[model samples]
Target chain A: MLRVDVEKQLGEFSLHATFSSEGRVTGLFGASGAGKSSLINMIAGLLRPDRGTIVIDGETVDDTASGIHVPTWRRRIGYVFQDARLFPHLNVAQNLDYGRRMNRLAPDAAQRARVVELLDIGALLDRRPGKLSGGERQRVALGRALLSKPRLLLLDEPLGALDEARKLEILPYLVRLRDEANVPMVYVSHDAAELRQLATQIVMLRQGRVTSFGGVKVLT
Target chain B: MLDISPAEWTAILLSLRVAIIATLVATPFGIALAWLLARRDFWGKSVLDAVVHLPLVLPPVVTGYLLLLTFGRRGLVGGFLADHLGIVFAFRWTGAALACGVMSFPLLVRPMRLSIEAIDRRLEQAAETLGAAPFKVFFTVTLPLALPGVLAGMVLGFAKAIGEFGATITFVSNIPGETQTISSAIYSLIQTPDGDAAAGRLVIVSIVLALGALIAAEWFAHRATQRLHGN
Candidate 1:
């Protein structure tokens, strides 16, 4: 479960969002500049909330009153940005292995092989990120995030950077991820259709406020 | 034909030693300062940046004099170091290295800072979310990406240290074998009546070293550009 009640002031806009979701995939649905990214960023611990608390999996990751703010790395979360920010110096295999090495987790060849096969990225392992196509890069990014064994996965417009054909190419993989992966996810997108297909619950936002919250029907 | 005598060879070897030692010693401090300048915004940031670049604009002789006062025998830091650690920098090869390091620092830091600045900060955030702490992110992501620039900086610094004349001469007084580098040696040779031939040979050596360093720096810069482009 994820709980968030946070207030932040950014220039002229103010964000006072409050919601809690027990859904396996909570789709944060909103238009551009509607604070969708900001809300998810707060959950990922990338952006600190000026006020209130965020609890992920019974752990209070952030609480302004108690001054409990867990840093991002310690949050044990995975984030996939719109731009696939792969390390240029590393090949795909190394990139996938990075988080495991950093976390000092014992090498799990089984899990690595499973994720690679799931994403169909085995052939691309030796290639540099620069060699991958747009869809291929997103798949690699997704695989990289999954291999970290995060408690929660936050994807901000993962498809936002892709073209229509590329989006079609990756949506099936995402659906498989939702059904197969044990980790809960917070998928943020402005596309209602995409949310309708994936989100078990929807939190609708407009101008930095949660205007509505419910099942996929709320997207309409 | 290059007919270099033993005295000239000593100066050449001394120059290489001073330059190498200076470059190696200053690199860690240079990388730290470069990262600080590139990735941070804090109080006194501009002031720190200006201080890092001070050697480039300040007269080398003035920098040397300041070093002498601060690190000379009987001076503040020098006195403490000598008394406690038995390390001395006054009128010695080590003093020449110190001077060269200071003189070459700005050149060493610029490329590193620029490369660090060029990195996509979002990538660092990605690393953090992937369970790498801030320092881990630096070692794994930021430093590797900025390696070409680091190499460029080191080459530039090494070249500058090798050719450093004014500050080195002022700080260590151009003592042969102890402090006289190629630049100082050439200075001495050119001043003597029959030393023109030796000076010419040393000048040729200097030109070759400078050209080689320039080429290496250029190559590193090219690699830096490619790395940034993710190619």
Candidate 2:
């Protein structure tokens, strides 16, 4: 479960959002500059909210009134950006293991094997991010994030940078993630059709405010 | 066949030692300072930046004199160090290395800072979300990516240290076998009537060493870029 009620003022744009979702996949549907990314960033503990609280999996990660703010690394959240920001210097396997190692979790061969097989990235283990195609990089990025064992996953325009053909190729993998990964996800995208296929819940935003928050039918 | 006098040989060995020591000593500090200047925002950031680059603009002799005031035997830091740590820098080869290190610090920092700044912040943020602490992120991601710049800085520092004359001569004096590096040795030889051949040979050696370091730096930087970019 993820709950958030926050307000932030960035230049002329002010973001005031309040929503909570227990669904497996919560889609943040908004156009460009609709504060979707900022909202998700706040939820990830990457950005602080001016006023309000954010609770993730029953733990209060951010509460402005009580001055409780957890650092991003301690929040146990995974974030995938639009650019699929995988570590270029590290190969696919090393990149996937980075989060686990950083968190000081002992090597789990079973978990590692499961993630690699789930993403069908077994062949890419030896390859660097630069050598991978657009769809492959995102899949690797998704695998990397998943291996961290995050409580909440934030996907900010994960498919925004892909072409239609590439999107079509990766959509099924995303559906697998939503149905089987067990981790709750907050998916941010401007594409309604993509959300319609994957999201169980939709939070619609317009100019930094949540105009609607409910089932995926709200996206219609 | 090339013939070199014993004194010129000593000078060559001494120059190499001083330059190598100077570069090695300055590298860690240079990287730390460059990271601070590139990624941090502080109240006296500009002042610190200026201070780091002060040796570049100041007369080498003046810089040496300031070092002398602070690091000489009777000076504050020098006295404390000599009395407590028994580490003397006045009129010693180590003093020459120190002078060279100070003179080349700016050269070691500029390229490093630029490279560190050129890194995408998004990568760091992603690392953070992946549960890497700030320090871990730096070592795992930032340092490897900034390696090319660090190598360039080391080369620049090494070249500067080798060619250093004014600051070293002023701070440690041109003592034969102790502080007289290749440059000072060449200067001494040029003053004698029959020392032209020795000075010429030393000059050629200096040029070769500097050129070698430059080529190595470029090659290493290219290799690092290729490895990082996976090309």
Error of 1 at B170 (Å): 1.0
How large is the interface RMSD of each prediction? 0.9, 1.3
Model 1 Cα interface RMS deviation (Å): 0.9
Span of 10 residues, lowest total lDDT, candidate 2 chain A: A111-120
Candidate 1 lDDT (Cα, whole model)?
Answer: 0.93
Runs of candidate 2 exceeding 4 Å displacement: none
Pairs in clash, predicted candidate 1 = none
Per-candidate DockQ vs. reference: 0.81, 0.78
Would candidate 1 be rated incorrect, acceptable, medium or high by CAPRI criteria?
A: high
